[model samples]
Target: MTRGLVEDEKKEEETEKKAKKAAPAKPRKKATKKPAPKKRPDLEAHPTPEKEEKAPPKTEKSAETPPKIEKKPEEKPLEYKNDIVEVSVYHKPGCRIEMQIKASQDMVKEAHKKAIRTVSKQVNFPGFRKGKAPPEMILKNHPRDVDKSWQQVIADVAFKEAQSLAKVSLLD
Candidate 1:
């Protein structure tokens, strides 16, 4: 029985080896790349000239006819006016405008008073409630704040007045 088992194992091994040898190998395909596209000629850079045919000469009647005249409509200039701030607007090319503004002396004085009041409201002073401090004290202590407030007030008023006069919407 042991000899019969050994002989069967040897026969299986021999069959596997013969099967491997009998199988043929398949051929492999080569990898290929697509061709590049051709470039188009630049006609604008080097334009080709073609022969143009000459037109028949104009008749005497066609030459005697007067050319038509076209009339253009008149355009009105833009106008701007303001009481507090004087605005001079210059219309430039490409739909743009330039403005020069000058605030009146009265406007400046009013702006200064308003700025002092605004600063006094925001800051507290000794023996005084918030927003009830004297303008003199606020001016003496917070000159820089007063100046900034004054400029802001003047700019706001001038911009609003200028926008209305010019009839143009402005961004803040």
Candidate 2:
């Protein structure tokens, strides 16, 4: 019984091996070639037709209606005087002689003399009594009085003239 069973196992293994070897193999397919693409034309190679720039259509009503105009009120000219202030000098030492006078050189000199005479009569100097000293003596002996009187008189005249100038500036 054992020998017959071993002989049956050997027959089963041989039948499996024969079945595997008896099966037919599949055939391989040949590769196909692809078609080439056609050439494309360049746009720059052929010139395009020049197109006319079409403007937007305008209405007749818009042409008849003119743009609103603005009229500004005329400005008044800045009131100015031709009175040229040719200030040859702005500031100087108290002892220095500097002025702005419209009169002639001789007239201005004469005016200075008159001013000195007038001021000397008004100021009280030390000694030699009051309002009695000559212009020369007052200028030499009482130099302080001479300087003060001269400044005061000139200032008074200048102040009167400046009043008009100040008014013009304020009004303008």
Candidate 3:
């Protein structure tokens, strides 16, 4: 059995060598280089003489004609007006603007009322259904929540008024 196995291995090796010899070899490509560009002559070394031509005679109409002056329309300043809020705008560098808004007392009071109503919706009180409590009771019980809501409402109102006055769109 060992002799047969050894003869089989030798036959396989010989077949592989014969197969390699029968296969054709691939051709290799040669590397190529580009030629350098030619140099151009300098223009300053060979300067050409310019021809002198007589100037055209000016007519009476052309000599007496005055240059035209264009007039630009004047621009009006922007005027911002609001009953609930006062806005003062300041122009800054890079096409940016800064606004100073002052809310009226009436606007503040209105915002405070709205804030109490908003806060009342989130809280529960005895002898009252959820979100149905009175604003006075809600404010008495949830002072912090009411104040936060009032601040948010006032900020929103001020921003809206400023945007309208400036005639500019603002991102929320």
lDDT of all predictions: 0.84, 0.57, 0.84
lDDT of 1 at 98: 72
Expressed as tens digits, the lDDT of each residue in 83-109 for candidate 2 is 422122223446442334332344335
Please provide, for model 3 over 53-125, each residue's C-alpha lDDT reduced to its tens digit, 9 standing for 90 to 100.
Answer: 9888988987899767896653443457688888877666587777778899999999999998888888888
Between candidates 1 and 2, the TM-score winner: 1
Per-candidate TM-scores read 0.51, 0.29, 0.51
Expressed as tens digits, the lDDT of each residue in 31-101 for candidate 1 is 98888967667534775698898987999977899767786653444556556877877676687777777
Off by over 4 Å in 3: 1-79
Better of 2 and 3 by TM-score: 3
Can you give the lDDT of residue 63 in candidate 1?
88
The reply for model 2, stretches above 4 Å from the true place, is 1-111, 122-130, 165-172
